[model samples]
Target chain A: MTLDLDFHSTLYLIGLIAVFVFALTGALAAAKRELDILAFVFVGIVTGIGGGTIRDLLLRTDQIFWIADPNYLTVCIVASVMTYFFAHWVIKIDRILLWMDAAGIALFAVLGTSKALSYEVAPLIAILMGVISSTLGSAIRDLMIQVKLVIFEPEIYVTACLLGSLSYVVLSHFGINEVYNILLSSGAAFLLRVLAIELDLRFPS
Target chain B: MTLDLDFHSTLYLIGLIAVFVFALTGALAAAKRELDILAFVFVGIVTGIGGGTIRDLLLRTDQIFWIADPNYLTVCIVASVMTYFFAHWVIKIDRILLWMDAAGIALFAVLGTSKALSYEVAPLIAILMGVISSTLGSAIRDLMIQVKLVIFEPEIYVTACLLGSLSYVVLSHFGINEVYNILLSSGAAFLLRVLAIELDLRFPS
Candidate 1:
């Protein structure tokens, strides 16, 4: 089987776009903090790249995403610069940040799981990586703001990623097309998260 | 040879102490930022448990440190509480914080290397894990404060841990006593870090 070079490359490109969107949401989240531009951009960069960086390190990838692909860095910087110039505009879009975050998480969770499986990790471990890759960026953002861990919070954040990874694994085991598996998995995660938010679903205290 | 159950049992203890040291340093650092007691304790726990947790997840170990040994959680909480009440006093001894951090790094480095080796990872991979274990706590602390990544900085932090792990591998190849290997490796890391600070040595630009 010729390596699905086109499909794999598309995933990488999608990942970079997700990074930009993630950074935009992060920039808006920090708008009220009275931070200087550098600090704002720094937080944005961290929020955008932190999860994948963690995933790469854990997977023992030879080079991390931004290190391997400077395009990711370029996009993050551009997004951050845009945020700095248009903080007021970003602040107005805060209402949509959660959905944007959900989109980013869906992309990350599916891609992370696929990457882990490609590395021949156990399915369970791959699923865990998926959850981590999705939640970790937001987790880093919250930690920087010194908030409680979203992983332990009431939301269905990591849980959605976990279920999505499971779906991918199960579908792949049943011989589903790789691209379709990823799309289905990411869609599952995105819809789950959006529904959870809309319904105000939360873990019981 | 049968696995050394005694040494295995004591490994958790070493990890526990490292967590306590990490927590205390993190709490002290947070206090300097004017964070409240809850924030200080949360920072402490994150600093304490973050590294080992990352290492474990990377190694696919089901038992994370705080999960396997609740004593570590207890230790982290206690250390946080102690630092909270005594931060001002401890800050007076701020000269020692770096050294304490270095010591914790050294301990965790060896522990992490050994664990990686036990999992049959390549020596190079083990060395990387050793460095991650040693430096991950401080990296998380820096990220929380939105500081530039120390790994990207000129600091000799990760370098010292790598050198120590290399020493361990060399000693093991030469059939040195295991305990001596651990001690020598850790001691070397501590000395190298302390000397680097004193001599103002840094990673070459």
Candidate 2:
């Protein structure tokens, strides 16, 4: 089984999209705090690449993704600055923001899981990598601004990513086709997230 | 100059000692919050290895130190649990805790700097890595517990790390002997931190 150049590029596209969405969410959160513009940018960048940074570092990649391609950082900065200036309009679409964030989680879950699998790490660690990739950015953001931890909140967010990564890794082990593996896995994650949002799902009290 | 087996062993010893000290601080912080025992252990582990974990990941080491050697984790757990059961006595020795934390910072500063320089990273990044390695564990602990951010509190903490790492890297570049490099660099950091404690130093308001 050989992955071509196109496969790598598509993964890159997914990663960039996820980073942008996460960056917007970060800037929005910072805006709510009425912090200065620089704070918005800093928080945005952290939210944008924080997970992937940790992921790459954990996997001990030769070059950090953002360091190798500054576009990710640039996107985060641009998105944050734009949101800082136009948060009023962005806030009007809070419903869309929720979905976009879900998409971001799904995308990052796939990316993190695939990266870990590529390193031939244990499946459990791969699943954990996926969760970390999807969640650490926002967790750091909430911590930085002293907001209640979204993960610690009785939400189904981490579960969605875990299922997504689990599905992908399991399918791969079962000899599924590569393209279908990604789609089905990410779709599973995104669907669970959507359900959680629409139904206010959470861990049982 | 080629580093010998003894040099590596010495670093391992320093790292273990530093991890123990940081773990004690983390457990003490959690004890103040009066959280459960598990929270104390969790926070202790985070505070114990958090800085070195980030440093290794950023440096792209082949294996994370803690993952490669679970002794570090064992030390953190032991330190935290002991602190949990012995908080009253520990609080009576608050003055000693502050100095022990300073020692941890200085030791980690040297460890972080030497690792980066071993990788031959640029000086600016080496200094930053040292600061991150020495401070990030405690920062994560503080953020986790939602105390006043020791780093952001207009204090001289980070500056001490920056200077400590700077001295190590600069001395290394100047062809200083390895033993002197380690001692002087860590000493510089520890001295500055001690001054901050005794004098209540802060950056200009």
Candidate 3:
């Protein structure tokens, strides 16, 4: 049976999950750098909300999502603190974090595209926004830690987001049900990411 | 004799100068890393516009300044290309670049504060935005190049911007003329930055 969630609620659920997972990845990355607790929180918060903040700004939304609802910021801080204290144990479950990150990327890709579409932006720019929202936060976090840029990595991260966003746009154009559209798009992206991770996919430099 | 330009025109002139100087610094940083031409352009564009972009996004402006006016992007690209090709010569004129950067910081600080006040943001938050606009672009560029954070350095950069923004707000509150407000605030910041650079002033860490 298909899920019965409404459109806005579905978006909210996915967005919250995306924030948590992205924050976890940010904290993990900071842990690798041996940064202080404050640094962990800083990187985590930036990575968690950075993409959506950029999207909201571009859309000229009256209030940024996190600023309007402080709960998102709280989630980021709590996740970061948790990660900082248990980094050693968390590192042991690194594979799980990778998969969670993949899921987060898929969700954000669709959400960003949908938000842009609602704003009546052109479809092409909407897709770009989706890719940007899914990937920019992590990229910024990587920069903060002085690591090699993730966008330049051989992995199929941004490509997965692009395809997912494209799929969502096309499905919506055809008047598909929102549930089916999200599921198909997110599934496609998630599968691509998982395959890339397992198969060691690399783009030519 | 006092200058006769309107507030808006003067702001535009200072903004253009700020973008050019910031782009130059970004290119110089990229050159030290032996980055390719694309990387040079990328860093330069990001450094030149990143702060204002952040400010505009936070204020929920209808269109980002550079996107609405392609001239800003063109300036960034041309400045980046010039710096990349003449990096050796550019490095030799490092003293001039430093002073120019100081001027940029001062101008951006005032501009950022004024924009936020126009949006009716609280004075305290407006002051914070001013500091962010003045310093964040270069900070991001430094991060991309993996250098120690400039804010962490004892150079008093943020402090100078903070004082400048505060001065502007206070002057404006007292019904000072826009020209005088801009000049006094910018002069204060520029002088402070020049002193810090020349005296090797370091804040106690």
Candidate 4:
């Protein structure tokens, strides 16, 4: 009756949740463009998996995560379809989308950093990859929908990811427990993002 | 001594030319956005290498072509900087940019398909990748600059790439000489793109 939360399983769980949220965001973005059902699915899949795909490419992984396991693709597609069917309901919940996107960013940042570290990349590059993974998907999605890039907005987005990823790398260097590292890093990012949204906090342009 | 034009070298040459032309197109796209010098270089790098990066990832290549050889990055950056300094003059030459972009698309399509085939991907997938590589970079560039996607225009951009890649694969299957295969395929694509531009041809939406 015990839950198995080993590092690998935990990472997988985080990735699954992140993908779902990212896909939802992608579908929402597509909806704003008044695209068709197929476009919804395409944008969902791209936004959900684009970051990890870029990371894997940079790391020279043998196979992309989605290609290695079809589960991620299924999750993205399902999320997209659901959002498509519920577009009216989903579009009304802008706050929910923002928070969900923040959660997805935090998890993806940590996941990307961990994967890069496992590949023995330099610490700085690993951090860059983490930020890239957390933020690039949404950026691509925004571009596809002809919206302003969130990163270019005055509000903090990539900065939160950078901070979260930096904290993860620093904690890992101190030999922190994986669970604690993930929680602390993701928590910090989520908190910062929430604060930025609520308080209109932004980095100086 | 006879000039060496083996398949590998020929492909490399085609790729080099494609990257350069793609960089120019990227710079031109950036100019339209009034992006600063750094943004020009950034967009140029993205547009010049984005397609091949996608191709390499899909093919599970050991290293991205630009990362393996810094020359591609150099070409993109240098082209961007030059275009930035000459933006006023460059903007006047719309026809030149269109032709250069068309050439880049033709070469990249063949190059992408050739690489995918070498990796033993399914013929259909290889062709798809070819079209993606040829067209996606410009799409990304347009997205970055908030311009309408060229693929969505009446112009026959993606169609030209599709035709080019298809011709290359079909010709290769017929045991044609590599030189003739590349020339005929790329020529077909380039010619089609030129015709599309001159005739204002467009696919029905």
Global lDDT of each candidate: 0.78, 0.85, 0.85, 0.84
Across residues B1-205, which tens digit of lDDT does each residue of candidate 4 receive? Answer: 1444466676677677778778888898888878899999999999999888878867788788889999999989988998999978877887987887888899899888988888776676677678878877877887778787665454677788989999999999999987889889999999999999889886542
In the range B49-133, model 2's lDDT, one tens digit per residue, is 8999889878878888775666887889889998989988878888887888888898788779888888989999889889999
State the TM-score of candidate 3 restricted to chain B. Answer: 0.94
Span of 10 residues, lowest total lDDT, candidate 4 chain B: B1-10
Q: What is the TM-score of chain B alone in each candidate?
A: 0.88, 0.93, 0.94, 0.92
Compared with the true structure, what per-residue lDDT tens digits does model 2 show for residues A1-205?
Answer: 2566777688778778889889998999999899999999999999999988888887788788899999999999998999999999989988888888898898789778988888877776677678779988988889888886665455677778878899999999999987889889989999999999999987542
Q: After superposition, how far is residue B141 of candidate 2 from its true place, in Å?
A: 2.3
Per-residue C-alpha lDDT of model 3 across residues B51-123, encoded as one tens digit per residue? 8888887787778777566567778888899997899999999999989999999999998999899999999
Give model 3's clash tally. 0
Regions of candidate 3 where Cα sits further than 4 Å from its true position: A1-53, A61-131, A141-146, A152-205, B1-7, B57-64, B67-70, B199-205
In model 2, residue pairs whose N, Cα or C atoms come closer than 3 Å (at least 3 residues apart or on different chains), thus clashing, are none
- After best superposition, candidate 3 residue A117: deviation in angstroms? 8.6
Q: Candidate 2 lDDT (Cα, whole model)?
A: 0.85
TM-scores of the candidates in the order shown: 0.58, 0.61, 0.61, 0.61
Per-residue lDDT for B190 in model 2? 90
- For model 3, what TM-score does chain A reach? 0.94
Q: Candidate 2, DockQ to 2 decimals?
A: 0.14
- Across A76-95, the per-residue lDDT of candidate 3 in tens digits comes to 99889999999998888888
